[model samples]
Target: MTFRIGSGYDVHALVHDVSRKLILGGVTVPFDKVLRGHSDADVLVHSVCDAILGAAGLGDIGRHFPDSDPLYKDISSLILLKRCANILNEAGYAIENIDTTVFAQAPKLEPYKDEMSHKIASTIEISPESVNVKATTTEGLGFEGRGEGIAAHAVVLIRKISKKSG
Candidate 1:
């Protein structure tokens, strides 16, 4: 019956000479080097998943999906996000909305914002308006500024499912 908000942030190191693919809101983006990780290394989805889990008091993405497990090797973050949604549902939490931001220095993302929003919303069964994805750069400052890697931040609001019917 109450509303709660949670924020999640994640960063991954960019390995040199590796392919880069930024996956935001379940949509894959084109870039020179992809994020390096045990899974697909989608920084955007990872942050979103963590936010939902944090809001629902379900730990974090790493706890639910361990990198040590070979089963998750190169796994699609979309799949991980689906699992996170199930966890929230099982805990009687209804998603209200989610806003996400991606930090990158190359391959402007403005062109793909719509597709990213639609994909993430559909994957979580939420209205497209409920999910928002934005992209920005550090203006050439730190690791992200140097294009060493990509990072994402997400804030999610959830409401407890009421026992009484409407």
Candidate 2:
């Protein structure tokens, strides 16, 4: 019954690129600007990955999947999330629940919250009820409010299910 908790935050600049799509929590949102990053740059998913890894005593996402790696270039963040899930399972940690928040200035995200939660939960092999996704605006107070970038924060609760075997 060992319980651990971790929190993570991530931000990425927004850029106008017709070739790039705005992806958040594994769901593509209709927006004129896309997040700029080496991978798909889904800030929400990245935050969740970091939270899960931290809770499991694993390193952050950058340590697991570096932006310098060609294999991750333009790769889907969902794949990275699945890998994090596998890492947690291998370490005998079971996810209890995850809560996340996204900050943005435009392209209202209310319509896509459910899909985001479901997709993230599915990727982690957990129930959708265990994952919660929320979005908010900075009220013109920061980079997100200025529409310059998007940021996300995530918190995860996990418990040790079994001891790792040597």
Model 2 residue 148 distance off true place after TM-score fit, in angstroms = 0.3
Which RMSD values do the candidates have, in order? 2.8, 0.6
TM-score of each candidate structure, all chains considered together = 0.92, 0.99
**Window of ten residues with lowest summed lDDT in model 2:** 157-166
lDDT of 1 by residue, 1-166 (tens): 6998878899987764355455656677766666788888888889989999999788999999999999999888899988998888888898999999999886688998889888888888999999999999899988999988889999999999954233
Model 1 TM-score relative to the real fold: 0.92
Quote the lDDT for 47 in model 1.
Answer: 93
Cα-based lDDT at residue 79, candidate 2 = 100
Q: Which residue pairs of candidate 2 clash? A: none
Q: How far is candidate 1 from the true structure (C-alpha RMSD, Å)?
A: 2.8
Judge candidate 2 at residue 42 and give its lDDT: 98
- True lDDT of residue 32, candidate 2: 89
